[model samples]
Target: MHRLAPLVFPAAGTRHTATVIFAHGLGDSGHGWAAFVENWRRRQRLDEVKFVLPHAPEIPITVNMGYKMPGWYDIAALGLSAGQLRENEDEAGLLESREYFQKLVQQEIDSGISADRIVLGGYSQGGAVALFTGLTSLVKLAGIVGMSTYLPLSLKLESTYIPKPASANVNAQTPIIMCHGTADPVLPYQLASMSRDHLVKLGYPVEWKEYAGMPHTVLPEELDDVEDFLRKVLPPSADGKTEL
Candidate 1:
């Protein structure tokens, strides 16, 4: 499959021992979230951790009257009300994106970063992909983050979704943080909460956070919590070891 090279932020510290790959939402590119890494660096946090921001492929979005945009997959429709997002999902597109993300993770592993030191995350449509990919990943990851998003192809997770061995659910115990806003109009808050509930029911340790009156956008407090979460999951290597 064809893919665009992701925007990479090299570790500011002397060595790179860990990595965080974050994806952007629909209509946005990797550049959209580059400031996230800058914010951490400004505070002298995660200086040894490299950040990979992957741009989603530009495709026609059905809900936007078929206009092409940077999206992980095609969204059939979206509404303020809950319960409609589960239908008409693009399964093939989702699987393709999952494969792309999995390859990115493998590249990190091949470069000497342990799978346990890599965290996968994303926002909105991208978040949905991260959640799906992390859950089905064969290699155990350090953590997973989903901001203002929900899980897709949720109904078929058990039967036809996950590949063999991965069906073993290697990252079942991996930490997962999901953040959402109560006033989100694109993907309703209820949808996100339901996705959280389903994952929890499936034995995943998912920490749910909600911001009152906030919309589809992120908030300062939300990023603060996410930063704190990253600190906990991808802390400095206890042995002070460096991959490169």
Candidate 2:
């Protein structure tokens, strides 16, 4: 499979501390989240944190009128039935994306950043992929952010390729920040709650936020919330301070 081009934002200053890799939603590319990060870099002066945005390969969404969009998996229908969504869930695609994420993580690790300094996040379908990859991957990360997405019900968390005790402990130690607009039309707010419930039930610590009256797209306030979450999860370097 062809790898999608990744939009990389290298840490401005000399010492790199953390890397945040973002995945875009259906019909979107890595550029979708660039504006937010650009604004954040300016406001927070995040000169030591590297940011990466990887585009998903364009594939036909079997359910969206055969619309060929950037997606990791296909949705058989716009109106998702619990069973169909669970059954038709693309396990292979999920694994493939996980491998791709692992490659990115390894690249960062090879570049001198530790595994614990990495963060993964995304929106909508991208959010789903982030959660899936973050939870299943063997390496422990600093955090995982999911915006307007739900947990993948297809694979049992226990059946993940990574070992259980270590993976569970790592996930528990790694903070998960999930933000959802109350009025989100694409992925309902309830789904976000459902995801939280599921993760919590599985003994994972999660920080969830619900924005009032916001639409499917992210708002400025939400972006601020994300920054705050990132700060809390992936703190600054050991000099006792961070720029952003």
Candidate 3:
């Protein structure tokens, strides 16, 4: 259960005001998205925001025929239908990964980053973890971002798994943006929309973005939207100690 060191990009500015911890999809490492951080740096944006990209540990993937790969959790099955995707979910794996993400967030807070100034985000399987963690976080966060992903452990939301009490949920009012593609071949469009609908039913406000003719991948336009979200949640602070 050892984790690989995360790929961290220090804030370009002298002041470290905010943080975004983004996770990669299954079979991908933190290095897979290094260019994203570099791209924002090239534009001189989010210069005061530190980016932390954590690498998921290698584990046996059932969908890949037990092949070892970088994954946040084990997928028992993969299908074009959303129902098929939720079958035999690895709950233990999901919780373990959630704990790991929580630890990373705590490290940032310990380093003086306000809890409300930190965002938890990811893609695909990583996104699932982010959603789960953000929903169940003890501390309030600035926002949550999920790209081309669906909610995990959806069935347990009303159960003891998620603590049904309103006071127990710190992220109930946190901003969440979920982006999905209509033509996704891996995770169907229905999954994203249904997940959003379910969250709305549970009284969570979600900002959903749909892309036309896009697949299970990130587009430049998607990045632009994400950049805007980051700016909205993590605005520039005159002093690095600004608390939201």
Candidate 4:
């Protein structure tokens, strides 16, 4: 398997206290979201958090008339409605992405960052991959942030993996942050809501938020929400506060 190179952002301090691997959406590369994180770091002041943005391999997408583009996996088709007869789910591509994603997480672990201090996040299709990988991860992660995306390969995953039921301390170890727009046309707002409901049923501790009349993209408000999520999931500072 070919390993994708990443755009690495080192922590500002002498040592990194946490590591975050955030993937990009279809047709996008690591450079796309680099600005978002730079803005986020500037606003949130998380100098102790190292960021990694991995470039998705360019592949022919069957749904887009087989045109090649940078994507976590090949999109078979778009699912605007849950009742659609055909869902373009690239199972093989999803599995391939999962393997690469695990390797990225492993690299962080080998670099001295504990599994619990590592976060996996993505937007759109990338978010779907992150959601799939994080849930099935052997090494528990600090958290997962998914925006404008839904759970991918849910049916196949259900057939293969049975998640643990949420107990007394459901999200005590690993939590989730999911946000979507109600007016999204590409992925559909209702579709994201359905995904959120499904995750809850599967015993995932998800903090789901909805934006009214928003489209299929991230907004300033959404970034603010993610910033708050980072503070909660990332490790605390020396003064016992999650300041950054």
Q: Which candidate tops TM-score?
A: 3
Candidate 3 local lDDT, 34-83, one digit each (tens): 99889987787787899999999999999899999999999877655666
| TM-score for each predicted model, relative to the true structure | 0.95, 0.91, 0.95, 0.89
Candidate number achieving the greatest lDDT relative to the actual structure: 3
lDDT of each: 0.89, 0.80, 0.89, 0.81
Q: What local lDDT does model 3 show for residue 16?
A: 86
lDDT tens per residue, model 4, 23-127? 989988889898889887776566778899999887888778999888888876775466561266777888899889989999988877778888999999999
Ranking by lDDT: 3, 1, 4, 2
Q: Lowest summed lDDT over 10 consecutive residues: which window, candidate 1?
A: 78-87
For 191-221, candidate 2 gives per-residue lDDT tens digits of 6787788788777789888889987888888
**How many clashing pairs does model 1 include?**
0
Q: RMSD in Å for candidate 3, one decimal?
A: 2.0
Selected candidate, larger lDDT, 1 vs 2: 1
Candidate 1 lDDT:
0.89
- Clashes counted in candidate 2 amount to 1
Question: Against the correct fold, how does model 2 do in TM-score?
Answer: 0.91
How well does candidate 4 match the true structure in TM-score terms? 0.89
